[model samples]
Structures are given as C-alpha cells and as structure tokens.
Target: MSTTDSAPTCPVHDFNHYAELPYGEKIEFYDRLRDEAPLIRNEFANGHYIVTRYEDILSVYQNAKTFSSSAVTVFNPNPTFKWIPEMLDGDEHRQWRKQLGPLFSPKAVEGLEQKVRERAIEVIESIAVRGSCDFMADFANQYPSFIFLDLMGLPFEDLDTFLHWEDEILHVSGEPEETARRRTAATIAVTEYFRTVIDARRAEPRDDLISKAIEFEIDGEPVTQDDLESFCILMFMAGLDTVSATLGSTFYHLATHPEDRRAIVDDPELIPSAIEEILRAFAIVIPSRKAMADTEIAGCPVKAGDMISLPLNAATRDEAVFDDAKEVQLDRSPNNHIAFGAGPHRCLGSHLARRELRIALEEWHRLIPDYRLASKSAPTEAGGQLGPSGNIFLEWDV
Candidate 1:
C-alpha cells in the first residue's frame, strides 16, 4: 500500500474500525486522510481505490462517465435484495432517472412546500410547549418522515414502520445475525406495502407522488409497477433519513455555536446562506463509487471495479477549498460543497431537503427563541449516508 508523507499520517486501512469512531473523532481522521492522501488507496472489507481530494471530489462529481454511481451503496455483495435505480449505470440509469426526475424537480417539490411547511410547523409546535426535547426524535425525525409519507400518500399510521425500516437499511452493524434478519424483514415488508399502494393508486389515482409515478410514462408507455414500487422504496429511505440526519447535525452545530446561531437568528435572510454553510460543514454522508475501468485520478492508479469510498464529510472541511473551512461562517460566499454529492447521480431531493432545513431553522428559532443543550452530553456519529444520530437534548424557557 502506498502512503503519503504529510502532516496527518494515514492509519492502516481499516474502514470497519474507522466506522466505529465517535462523530467528531471520525471527522478528524478523515481530515488527516484528505491532507495526506488526497488520492490515497486503502484496504476495506471488499476493496479500495483512490479517495481523491476536495478538488478531485468536484472533478469526479462533474465527470460521472468515468466514476459511475450505479454501485453507490457498499454492501457485502451477497445481500439478497437492492434498489434498482440506485444500482444502475450509464443508459439504464438515465432511463430510470428520466422516469423519476419530474416528481422531485424544484417545481414539483414547490407544489408540496405548503404541506411540508404545515407538517414542519405541527411538529415544531408540538415540542415548543415542552421547552425540552430530543430534537432528533421529536422534531427532525418526525418532520421529514411525515413529509415523505405525505408526498408518497402513504398511510399516516405507517410512520413507525417507515422509521424502523429506514434505520435497519442504513445502519448495518452490531449483531450481524439480528441485523440481517431485521433488514430482510424490513425489505420484504416495505416492498409489499408499496406494492399495495401502487395497485391502489393505479385503480384510483390521487394527487400524490406514488399516483403520479404509477401513471407517468417515458415515451408512450406507463412506468412499470415494479419500477414505481422500487423508486417509492428508495424515496422513503433517502428522502426521510438523509434529510433527518442532515437537519439533526445542523441543529447540533447551531446549538453548540451560540454566536453562529445568533448570527442567523439576527438576520433571517441569512438562513439560506447559513443552510448552505451548514450543509457544507456537516456533509456527513460518505459517498462510495465504483471505478468503471482501470483509470488514474490525481496520480493514483484505480483498477476496474475497485470500490472507492469518498469521505465527503472530510473533503468539505478541506482548507484548500474553503478559507477557514472548519469555522461555521453563514456569510461565506460562493460555497460549493458536494453535500448532496456530485455527478449525474446527485441527490434528486436536494431542493426539498434544503427547503426543509430552512424551515427548521427559521421556525424552530422563532418558536423557541431561547434554547440550549440539556446538559454537556456529547453527540453520537455514524458512517455511510447517515451522519450523526441519537438525541440532541435541548432545554428552553416555555
């Protein structure tokens, strides 16, 4: 294995061990990795390749033809099931995305913003009276989960199932036997549930995403029910969990950094830029891509089919890209971090995700003007698409 002589040296390539590190410490580890081996390769459970630097991440984002996103999820390869659109490359991916794109476009999402804001307000107001709550469970989790469910026209009572299944799919660790069983069960359950929704929507169409997807056509043929169901499952997991995790991390930053919090609160207009800064700083999702053919990136040799994990959370903090990259500066101009990722496979729900975050900051602060940490309890972090987890306990005078 090749190594770089730099300020922060690389640890022996042990991704499993690295995944177990606490949130902040993990960020530190990736920072060193970015500084030393911008295009360094490491040994992972499956394989490894060049984890290029901040600039490289942007380049890879722009040049999707070379660094394909079809194999975005890093799995044991033996798993029985996987989502279709997320795992397709080239023309196939284009077809799937073309069929699915219109639903999540800015205009389409804007049509749902009223309902999304209402849901956000409802959850925020529910906890406002308590003056103390776990921001993740009470507000962050509930808000996006509800928005996703509402958008899909899913059953309101199915929120618990949605949350549970999403957790199982994202966090694949601890008690391998139990995790496997739960994941399998959740997959079967959710797929069957969506299948039923697709049938119902087909028979009697509604003004919801599922219904639209059911009737939507590419060329002249309506989308297959199987494709619609698969896309539905992907939306449930990605739309809900990714936004929830991002908002959770953003709230934690704002609570911890009172000055930064006050800066946004003082100037409501700054919330948009503040959202961008927060997304850039707390880009917790570590995106993985498979090298299509043996290629060279930033002087690193990558063989065909080698799995490459990009520590985007780390790259966003690279000093070369942003002046004072570590600090939370809402006024930072021309911020171009790939929190939503880059390339042809960038997040379709990014616009909706941003809107949700903006609403969370603007409304939460308006309702609970004075809030602080419940205690000095530290935050928990995790790897993969999910960032930090656990309760962000906050206390405020009602």
Candidate 2:
C-alpha cells in the first residue's frame, strides 16, 4: 500500500497521451496498455505511472487523500495556474462544489433542455440543406458553444474569439516553448476578457451564470477576483471544449457504423442509450492525479509527489468490468461506465453535458438522419485533456 526504497518495478511504456494518433488507435493503445501490464511508467515528460485496470483506477479516484487533485495534468505536474474547483480538494473543494451545485443541478439543466435543443436544431438546420458541411465547424462545435455563450450571458458575436482562445489554451501544438507561449498568451487573453465581464457585472448584476457566481462566497468571505478569473478560465475551457470533442467522437462512430446510425434513426428512443454506449466505447478523458503520500496502486509503487494517470477509456473498455466491453451495444442496460468519471470529483456538469449530447443527437437525427464522412476530405483528431481535435466533416443527401 506504500512505496519504499526497494519498491516493485513496473514495465516502462513510452506512451504519451498528448501525442496525436488516429482516434481508433487511441482506444487500441489503451487496450494494449491494459493487456500489457497492470500499470506502466509512461516515459513522457517526467515519467508517471499509468494505471490501466478498472478497479485500480477507480480506487485512486475514490481515495483522493492518497492521490490528490492538486495536479490534474501529467505534462505539467506542477501547473503554474489552478483550474478553480477542479484543482481544489477537501473542505475547500466541497464548499466550492456546494456553491456551484445549483447552477448545474438536474433541475437547472432540465430547465435548459429546450434552449439546448433549440440551439442544436438551429445549428443543424443551417447546414441540413447544404448537403455537405464540416460537422465540427458547422454543427458540433457551434451547437454547444452557442448554448454556453447564452448561459454565461456572453455575446454570440464573440464566439470566434472564444474559439481561438480555446485552441491556444487547450489544443496548442508545437515545440515545447512555443506551446507554452501560446497557452500563456491565450490564458492572459481569456483572463482579461473575463475581467471586463466581471467589472460590468459588478456595476449591474445580470441574469447569467457569471452574475450568479459573482455572489458566491467561501469561508463567509466573498470570492476573490483571482479565484473568479480562475473559475471563468476553467468554465471557458470545460464549457466550450468537452462536449464538442465528444460530439465529434459520437458522429465519427455514426458515420463509420451505418448500422448503428440506422438503429438510432429508426428508433429515436435509443439515442440516450446509444450516446451512453458511444461514451463508454470512446471515453476520451485521461485524468491525472498527484500523489499526496507514498503509495502503491495494484502493486505499482508510487512515491510522494508522483503523478498517476487514470485513463477512463481503459476503465470503460475493461473486459473484467463489462460484458462485451469492446463492442458498442446501443441497448446496453445498466451501463455503469465512468465516462463522466467516478468519486467525489466526478464532473459537476454531467447533467448538462448528457442533456446536450442527447438533445444534439435527437435534433440532428430528426433532420439529417443519414450522413457519412465527406468523400473529399478526411476527419482529423488531436490528443490532449479533451480528446479529438474536431475536424470531422459529415455530408448527407439533401
């Protein structure tokens, strides 16, 4: 249960989660990792242990004390910036979660269902008659992002700017120093942008999440501007990126698997289950945790301050956990995959995310039920915190 000077060694795998690979190969890589060993030292950017077993990954997530949320990315184990409530743990984390709960509660997301559906419809309708459209650009990314802007009380006109920021902050690729510079620049731009918004909200409160959050207090003291900026940064990245990448993955599945697509188009009721199955099959997030103390995960020795990566895709695809684990069964009952993650730090916006995914599928299929990958172009993807870079172009007969 603890690491020692003479701890057991694990096989080293030069796996880099951030390295670009075909989306399908990413799943295969995880499967290979799981089959190769219980855990292996990922020899990329200050080597970290990657736990490939479902139960073991679950254990690390559930035991937050031993594996802290202080550092969520392995690339920069000690990140210069914090992502608000995400990087917080213990009582502070609980308090922040409590304050933020109502905004993403089931009832709140339910109230937003119509708006979510409307945006999905609007985005799809604009491209439906075109017969050929880049799903990521024309639909997938636009659908969720518009909803996010509306919810945040931000102007829709600034979406292009926001998208640029998202790329710099989340999808920057190049030499290490160049990547760092772009990320830093984007972070500054977002912080400045939010600063203006916060200042405006301070003068006259608005009926948006930002205004609502402006009133949030921790420890009986008002939340600081820096903390609010951090929250905005985190929300900007999460609100804009995660669902889009997921939608890209989902549509890719449908485009390639016509049978599964027809099954859903024939029975719209299956969209929810289909979405769940797709999420399980293409689970993209790879959450990292920093060790708070010496420990061992499934016999893999981990020292204090060591980083551990828990790839959710590996867990969801684990044969030991699920029946027909690798296959995507649209009607999978009691699907208990941790695609949204497990434990206390599980995604707070799961309700909203699921609603978005469901609504997007429902509306898009209702209109453009039959579509396939563009014949002239190929889909593209990248690796990072959120998987899939979103160059998925889908075309349909008008």
Candidate 3:
C-alpha cells in the first residue's frame, strides 16, 4: 500500500518496445510498474524516467515550471519533429496556449457541433447497414478526420492524405531510417497543406477556425503563417487521433463487456457517465514533461533536462484514488480523472471530445445495440496515437 517505492532494480531495456506489446499485456506491465517501480529509470533505447504512480504523474503535470514540455519528444528525448506549441513550456507555452485557447472553447465547439454530429452520422451511417465493418477505418478514423477538416475548412478530398500522414507520423514499425523518412515526408506534406489553406483563408475569408486565425491578432500583430500552420497541424493531429482512439477503445470495451453495454443501453441517460468512465479506464496518451530545473517529485530526485513520461492511463486507474480501481463502474461519482490531462497543458479540445463521444455513443447504440466483436479477425495491434489500430470488426443482426 506504499506509494513511495524506489526505482526498480531490474533494468528495463527497450522501453520503447513496450509500445508494440499487445494491449492486455501492456496494461498488465503498466500495473506492475505502478505498483513496484513508481520511478523506474527506463534505460531502454532511450534513457528516461518512466513515472507510473498517479501522485507522481499528477505532481509532474501540475508543476509546469519545474517539469517543462518544450523538449523534442514529450515521452522520450529522441523526437522526429521539431518543437511546436505543445512542446513549449513556461511563458512561451502560456502565450501559445492563449492564441489557441478560444479556438476550442465550449462556445466555439458548440458552434461546430452541428457539423461534427453531421459528419459523425455520415460516417456511422455509411457502415451501419453492412452490420460488419472495420470500425477503425470507417468510423473511428473517419469521424475525427472529417471534423478536423471542417474545423480548419480544408478540402474534404484531402482526408485520405491526412490519414496517411497521421499514420506515418504516429506509426513507427519499420526500419529507423525509413520511419524517419516517412515522418519527414508527413511533416512537410502537413505543413505545406496547411500553409496553402491559410493562404486561401487569407485571400477569401470564411466562417471557420482558420479564417478566424487569419483575422486574430496577438498584441496588434497578425498571427504568423508558421504559427498558424503549426497550430492547424497540431489541431488536426491532436483532435483526430485522441478522439478516434477513445471512441475505438470505448467500443472495444463495451463490445467485450456485455454487462457494461447492457447497463448503458438500459438507462441511456447514463451515456455521459459511461463516456467518462470509459475514458478514465482506457486513459490513453502517455504524455511526457521535462524537468526545467532540479526538483523532487514524490520524494524522487529529478534533474533539469531529464525526460519524464507520465503514464496518464496508470494514474487514472491508480488504486489509491479510486475504489475498486480496476472495475469500470458507469455510475462512478465525482470522477476527476485527468484523461485529457491537467494544469495549463490540459487538452483544449475536451469539450469537443466529450461532444463527439456522447454523440457517438448515442448514435452507435441506436444503430447497433446488439453488436459483438467478430471471432475471426484479430484485434488491431497498431500502437502510436490510435493504439490498437486493427479493425474492430463487430457482427450484428440486421
């Protein structure tokens, strides 16, 4: 019952390889790490601290000054892309966050909800009749991609290109050189594509976030093209992958757990609670923060420039906070889980994400209430942003 455990004696080599492990195995491994080695030093390919305990992770996330987010990689030191807004820490981070804040507020997102719901329905209806479909490709991936495009006012024709680019940046299964090349190509493509969109928005203003960005001035100066493009790219990748993964994970959990499905379906009013519970349980995103200066977190010494991976998933499921930590109770009250994250770096798109989840659950249950996973096809093992990327095939009676 002690949370102040020392680093593990057993050297954890190839920590990055944990990303490739099966979902169930990964969960088990994380549980063990949280219980035994709260501050384990991951000397795998990348040397970093693997923070597993809930208190430790929360402490790191809250102290933005101490734990910076401006590092190359959020999780590890080696990063393929250069520093963007999400990577910034301190006042620079605050400035960038201010620029992007109003763009995802409840008012802003509420204005976009109609479009999002329409897009969600369109994607959902396309495959609902088949009674058997690749949920990831057809719905999970499609829904968020379309929403992001609409938010940025990008051409719908570019959805496939965006998907491919996201896959490349996120999925690193191939050779190191090849993965790096693919990531570079994706970055260039995304930057160029958004740059064009920004130009178009400037020439002919429209009622969209990109257009607003063009008009928006920080300190009486128009937002720079580089900043706009970077913001757009961040919005696209961040909005799409996290929501899609959450949707997929939600479906995966409900489909497998008939009792949970029945509980939600029976009351329907509990859908919102169900969404929160699912997010709490399947808390994806192993967000990282850097130590801006020497600090002690949960009594563990951390130095400046050290990369710290806060396993949000492990923290949400921490036994210290939640009763029956492993169980997924739809009625779990006063749930303060940090699935979207915490402090100044909390996800700005949370309201939108919640809307999507609520709409998705409502519509999905209405369309296919009795769906169950297929026995033939295996679950997706694709990691990265959308963990378990394989098609979540479900069989239902039409």
Candidate 4:
C-alpha cells in the first residue's frame, strides 16, 4: 500500500532492494536515495522508514534501547526466527557478545593469519595459473568457506553443500512466495544440520568454535539448545557470506580501477587501508531496528513497533561525514566508517573478517597482481540485501 497523506508527511520512495541490481548501479542507487532525503518512508515490501545520513544512522545505532533489534529485516517487521546475538538486546546481547568475543579477538585472528594466508595462496595459485577464472567461485567463495568450516570443525568436504544452503537462504531468487519457501526450507536444513553437530559436540567435545560455544553459559544458565542452534545458524551465515561478499565488491573495484590495484600491488602494506576504503565505499549491510517506543528520527515520526531500515552504504557515503565518500582511496586514513555496523549488535566476526580479507588481498596481489574484468559487460550480481552475492569473473595473462 502506498502512503496516504494522513500517514507521516515524509518522503516516500518505493523500491525493493532485494531485487537484483548490478553492483555498481546499486551503489549509485544508494547515493541517489541518500541525496533525496535524510529520511524516506520506503514502501517497498512491508513499508519502513529509511535513515540515510551518517549522523542519523549513527544515532539510531547508538541509541539501541530506543531502537531495538527485534526485527533486523525491513521486509519482515516481526521476524519468525532469531539470529542469536544480533536479534538479542540489552544484557542478553551483551552476554552473547562477551562469550563469543574472545574467539574473534585480534590476537585470536592473528594466530590464524598464517593458516588464512596459506588457504588464500592455495586458492589464488590454482586460479592464477589458469590465467582466467570466475573470481567469486574459484577464490573468493572457496577461501572463506574453507576458513569458516575449519574454524567450526565442520567437514571441508561439505563446503559445497554449505554454499548451496547459503545461496538458498541469502541469495534466494524467485517469485515472492517461492523465495519465502526456499528461504524457510534452507533455514530448516541449516538448523537441523547444526542441531546434529551440537548434539555430537555435546557427546564428544572437540577443540573448535562449535564445541567451545556448546559449553557456554549465558546469564549464569547453560545456553539452551534453541539458543545454541540460533548461534550456529548466525555463525554459518556470517562466517560464510560477509567476507565473501565484501571480497567480491573489493576485487570488483580493484579489477576495474587499475591505479588502486597497482598502488596496493606496489606497496603491500597499503592493503589494510585499501580494505578499509573498499569496505567504506561498498558498505553493503542494511541493518534494521524496531522502535521500542514512539520516537522522532530526523524530525520524522516513528511509532513503537515501526521497523527502520538503516543502510550502511548510505551512512558510509554521506557527503556530510566523509570527504569524497564515493571515491575509494587506498590510503584513506582515519576511516571511521561503520561498514561492520555500530553499537551493541556490531558484527562479532569483524577481527576474523579483517584478517581473512587482508590475507586474501596480500596473497592475491603477490601472485596475480595485474588482472581485469574477463568480459566487457559487468559481472553478474545476485543478492543485494546483504551485499552482492558473488558471480564476479576476472582474468589476466598467465
């Protein structure tokens, strides 16, 4: 239903972000929306408020109590399922974070750097020698999946199966009803798979994240089976996708922009800064929060239970926040962009994500330093809700 005059007099932009769009054009779309208004009542799916500016979005993130994360998706104001720490709030959310924080801490991630690089090198070498390959399928997707499965102590052989489930859940493409059905089925499959793993880990504990998490106690009580499954599901999605999508965007940028690519190749140390800039430029995650009580954001009225869509791309690209926000500067310093998000529900895997991304870039540039788009046309794009779902193909002389 379109907005009626009686409905809050805010700008209404009706567009379904879940609809597939070329990765570059999607970034442009974000810029257009950001410039249109600070707040837009986007009536795309279930109709929700969109906070576009950096300051406004940051305010929403910081004031988590006022803006609860009960429902993180704009399309579903009331999500049927919980995604663990992300969907939890206040002390419960804090407890989950505290319990899981150490695993992804810088030191912990640092310990895995050598292994991460080895995996990256293995994947890159296999493709670099081929001279041409689907970067997403060959390297981006495989590297992260390997790391994640290894981290969780899941069978590396099941990488393909997990990827299939990931596509169904995160990159579902079909009619609206079909999409929902596929998503539901995949979610169940993932939950069932994790439950089995949890049960096994309980009977025979291993030295992996899953086993460690299985033994966690939240709020002085042993974590429930449902909560454990929720954690596993969340980890499965995050562990497999976030870094993969970010890598696709980052590499697409490098493939198209030779100067940025060359700069990183010439000075490997700049890869970390380059990764930050890429993340800022391609801020993909659209975090949603429900209003706990009636509140006003940027002069727009938000009633209690209202779902607000906060696109990190808009926040990162806000002209008022970062100078040349659209440009990807490899040496961008003081890059205080919230690509991983902000506040209590910030991404738990940020440290590990950074390590994986950096190592991937470092190893790839070390081997295949000069590469470009394999085709004149843009690479195929998939899911937009979380980020571009990888189908990017690149090539260079062997």
Candidate 5:
C-alpha cells in the first residue's frame, strides 16, 4: 500500500498515511488497516496511534478520561487561545456543552430549517441556469458559510472573507512555513474580529450565539473573555467547515451514482437515510486526542501523553457493524454511523448539519437529477475532517 509518505520509519497509520491519496485509495488503505491492524501506532510527528475497528474506536472515544483532548492546542489548553468544550474534559467539557448545546439542540435547529432551505435554494438557483459549475465552490462551500454567519450574527456580506480565512486554517496552501504563516495570520485576524464582537455583545446583547456565549457561565461566574473567544473560534471553524466538505462528498456520490440519486429523488422521504449512508460511506472527521493517562485500547498498552487518533472515518465502514460496509446504500437502515462522532463530544452542529444536508440533496437532485464527473478522473478526496481538497466539478444539461 502506498503510504502518505515514504519516510523510512513512518508507520502506515500516520496521518500522512492517507495523505496525497485519492478517495478510493484512502478507503482501501483504511480497510486494509481495519482488517489487518485495527490498533496501529505510528511514530510520526510527536507519535500517535490509530484505533480503526468500530468497537475499538468506540472504546477509545468512550474512555475520554484515558484519552484527553486538551493536548489539542487548537483552542483550549493553548497559551493564548481557549478552545472551549472540545478541549475540556470530564465536568469541564460537560459544563461547556451544557451552556453551548441549546443553540444546536434539535428544537432550535428545527426553527431554523426555513432559513436553511431558503439558503439552499438561493445557492442552487445561482448555479441551476449555468448547467455546469464547480459545485463545491458555487454551492457547498458558500452554503454553510451563510448558516454559520447567521448563527454567529456575523455579516452575511463577509462570507467570502470568512471562507478565505477558513480555507487557510483548515487546509495547506504551500510549504510548511507558508502554511504555518497563513494559518497564524488567519487565526489572529479571526480572533481579533471575535474579540470585537464579544465586547459588543457584552454591552448590547443580541439573539446570536455570540450573545448567548457572552452570557454563559461556569461555576456561577461568566466565562472568561479568553474562554468565550476560544469557544467561539472553535465553533466558528467547526461551523464553517464540516458541512461544506460533507456536501461536497455527498454531491459527488449522488452525481455519479444514478441509482442512489434516483432512490433519493424518487422517495424524497429517504433523503435523511441517504444522508446517513453518504455520511457513513464518505465520513470525513479524523480527530486525534492525547492519552491523558496510561490506558489499554483493546489491550494495546498506551502511555500518558501519547496521541491517540479516533478516526471515525475508518470505524463507520467497519465490516463488523454494517453489511456491504463500503457500498453507499441510500436505504441503509439502523445505520448507526458515527460520522458526527460519538460520546460527549459528538458534533454539536449535528442537528443543523443533518437538516442542511437533507435539504441540499432533496433540493439539488430535484433540479439536476442527472449529472456525472465532467472528466474521466474521479474528483479528489482527502481523508481528513475538513473534506476534499479541490473542486468537484459537474456538468449537465442547462
């Protein structure tokens, strides 16, 4: 199997293990590992291990105490940035989730579907007449930005600027130095922007997530400014990216697979199930947690400070759970997929994301029921959480 890198000592399970690979190869590699080395460790970077089997992955996720997320300097635990609930654990994680969860609760998202559908329609209309367009750029990427901005009470007019900042943070644009430079700058700019917003909400609160965050408390005291901004940044990046990539992959699949596309278009009611299948088959999240204490994953010895990767992308396709594990069955029921992840940190935006995807598929296929890859090459896919790296272009009758 071709690894993400050729470093002589790089283990096959390295993040780079799936790096540079196309969509199919990434799956083949994951399957190879799940079947052969379900619990594999790599010494790449600061050294990390991947738990691939469904049960084993669950074991790791469920035992968050043993597998800490605070090591992620992403927002929480960093010197300056505070990542909020994601970087917290135990009661701390629970408290943050409690304060933040209501915004994404099913009831809340239900009220927002009208807005979601309208946004989806607006995005689709922009491309419907063209007959051919870069679906990811025209629809997928832009669609989520609107919802996220609306949630944050940020200006819709700034979607392009936000997406641009988002791209730099989630993706690599050049050499390690260049990528690092751009990412750092993007973080500073977005953080400063949030800092201004946070202060505004403190003075004159609004019905936005930011205002709610400003009012949030832990242990009877309002959350610290750094903590609030950290949570917001985490939410900002998380909100901006996941659904877009999922849309890109789901659209790619439906576009190429007429049978599946037809199943959704014909049934319409089956769109949710289709979304689940697409999520399972094209799962995108690949989060890594540091081992908080000495633990055993399926009996594999793990020491404290070790980085343990909980690749839900691999687990969703485990043969032990779903039949025809690799195939995208639109009607795949009792689906029980972890595309949104599991345990305490399951995706906070899942309810909103689910509605967005279902609405997107229903709306798009309703218009363009038939389309295919514009070129012989399959659209590029990356195994990381942020989704595919490049544009997934599609062409159809105008």
Candidate 6:
C-alpha cells in the first residue's frame, strides 16, 4: 500500500553522523532513531533512507519491484563492483540462482560440515597455547579464510594478500574520494588476481569448484571469462568479510558478557541457539537498495535514485518485534530476524556462516572458554558488509 498525504512525517535528522562514534554507541544511536521514526532521511553519503524498524525493513525487502538492489552500498555513490545475485534483480537474479545456487546451497554447505568443524578446531588449537592473541587475526579471520579456501580451492599461501585487500576495501577512513580510490584499487588488484586463477583453471582443470565453474556454460553457450570473474569477485566480497565480522562481534559479546558466555559454556547444546541470537544482535552487514520507482516507505515519500539503507543490523533490536530487544537471550524462541536479509538476495552463505559460528564458539569454549577484551584498542565499525572491528584483541588464561 503506497502511503499518500496524511502519512507519518519523518522526525530523524543528522543521525548518520553516528558513523563517527564507537560501534556500540553507534548501535545505540540507531535504536534511538528507531524510537523516533521507522523511516528517517539521511542527507549524507549521497543522501539515503535510514530504516530501523523491523517490519518496515521487511516491507521494503519483500517488495523488490518497488526497491532495487542496484544501489547496494550507501557509502560508495559510484560502486566499484556489480556483485552478483545481490545486485541482479527480477528474472536476471533468478536465472543466476539456478546455476550458482548449488555452490552455496544447504546440501553443499552440509557436506562441508566436517571441514568447517575441523578448521574451527584447528584455529582454536593454534591460539589456545598463546595465552593471548588478537582473536580476529589469529583465529576468527583464518577460520573463514580456510573454509573459503576449501570452497574455491584457492592456495593457502595467497591468504595474506587476499586478507590485505579485504581490509583495505572495507576499513575505509579519511575523505570519501580517497577511500573510494583505495577501495577501487584493491578491487582492481583482486580482480586481476582472479583472472589469473581463471586462466590457470581453464588450462589445467582440477577437482575444485572453481575448475568446474571455469568449464561451465549458461544456457547453450559457454559462459564468458568476464562472467566467471564477476562471480569469483562477488564470492570473495560476500564470503570473506561477513563471517569474519559476525564472528568478531559474537566473540566481543561473549567476552564482555560473562553470563551470556556462561549460558553456552554450561550447556553445550545451547551453542546453536546462542549463535543465532548473536547473529541477530550483532548483524555485521548493512546492504542498501535504490528506489526502483518513486515509493513510500513507512508512509514517507522516497524519491527514485534515493538510496534506502537497509540496516539489517538494527532489525532484531526493534522493541515491538523482539522482547528485550537489546539484551542477549540465547534461548529466545521464534527468533526470526533478517540478519541474513530477505527475499531473493538473502545471504547465500547463511548456512555456512551459521555452521562456522556455532562450531567456532563451541570448540573455542571447549578449549579456552574464559577470556576478555584485550588491547586498549576497541573494534571500530567499517564497510557495508562487515562493520564490527576488523582487529579485535583478546587475552585469556592458558
């Protein structure tokens, strides 16, 4: 239902400035904005809509015809990459899902469960004897990196270079244009590297998924290298940063909140539910969509080209939706948050992400459960995909 005159007026102003605050304080700012209005207007970052309410976000998400994902990022007005599945709309997106769906599908992710658990355990063992380590660097980052390696059959030696690119692309600072330039450079470097991989895979195909994709065809014709490159780049962007960010935030939560950590430590079975609650509470990704046609969001008139900030990070905190919205309750039933997003582009790696999170926390607690935030430096929010701190330092008893 399109809202006309007599609809609610937006009361939010100057709220996007919270990006300058600490990540937790920033989340608080979002909650306050949600209390004021469901749909607020932000004039910064090339002007966009700041959505906080749970239902309002869902309404926009489900009605894809009115809202398009072409404008996927709010920070970069001129984005560098056209991410697959997420950026494509209507029939175009559906068609890609058909061909690429199995790669991230539940069955495929399920088959990789042992690998995820093994990697989680391996990461924990590597750091358990350190007595202290930057959780994000030593464990959180590498766990997902290894899993992505298994999925794409990328070489482990190149992990450092890829991680550097991921950080440079996401941890933007200083002026917007400079940040964009840095981000673009990183994207270009990563794209060129993937081209080399494609070339190698084509000449000497292996048993890995990347090799299979190299020889793949869409419709009756052979798929273009450009198609293969775009798909690989999208996987890196979507796969690497998101899981790492979520794992960082979840660890942050557990370290700071002892009882929340104890809830899982005491009852191992609760780890799965705990992971879901953590994902909802500390949603790392905040994807945006452009208004396809002039549409009304929560009764506010949204102009075409006006970008809508779908802060899935704030969806679970809607008081009307989740009881004790801000508090971390692991056993909360009917926990239906859009941390993975909604509609067609909902996170492709949600299953893998969940598996990785659950296995990580469970295995870590089994080995080294008691830990706290270390390194006076706090985690700062970054890029649209992963916004907790890229570097979260933690110390613990050996």
Clashing pairs in 2: none
TM-score against truth, every candidate: 0.89, 0.95, 0.91, 0.95, 0.91, 0.92
Candidate with the larger TM-score of 1 and 3: 3
RMSD of 3: 3.8
- lDDT for each residue of candidate 4 in 17-95, tens digit (9 for 90 to 100): 6676666776688798889778888776667888889999999999989999878876667777899989999999998
> Can you write out model 5's per-residue Cα lDDT over 201-314, one digit (the tens) per residue?
989998898898888779888889988888888988888788888888787777778887778778899998888988998788777777766667766666766666776778
C-alpha lDDT of residue 282 in model 4: 88
Model 3: which residue pairs collide? Answer: 14-44, 380-390
Better of 1 and 6 by TM-score: 6
Indicate the TM-score of model 6: 0.92
Residue-level lDDT of model 6, residues 1-398, one tens digit each, is 12222235876454444244455776777788888888887766656778889998998888888888776777654454576657878876787778777877889888988888888888889888998887777877788888887778898888888888877776666566777788889989988999999999888987776787776666666767877787788888766688887888888888888988888889999998888888787776777887768778887887766778887867878889999989889898889988999988887788888888888888999998788888674766754333424457888887
- Can you tell me which runs of candidate 6 are displaced by over 4 Å? 1-8, 12-20, 76-81, 375-377, 384-391
Residue-level lDDT for 109 in candidate 1 = 76
* lDDT score, candidate 6, position 137: 76
What's the distance in Å from true for residue 23, model 3? 2.6
For candidate 4, the TM-score is 0.95
Give Cα-based local distance difference scores for all models.
0.72, 0.83, 0.73, 0.83, 0.75, 0.77
Error of 3 at 122 (Å): 2.8
Q: How close to the true structure is residue 304 of candidate 4, measured as C-alpha lDDT?
A: 81
Residue 22 of model 4, lDDT score: 63
lDDT of 1 by residue, 1-398 (tens): 12222123323354552244444776767777777666655655554643647887777767777776666544443334446567656776777688778877889878877887788788889898887888777877788888888777877787776787877766656544565577678878889988888888878999888876776665567777777777788887786688888887787787888888888778889999999998888787776776677676675566666666776766688898889998878889989888888777777788888888888888888877677887844566655433324557888887
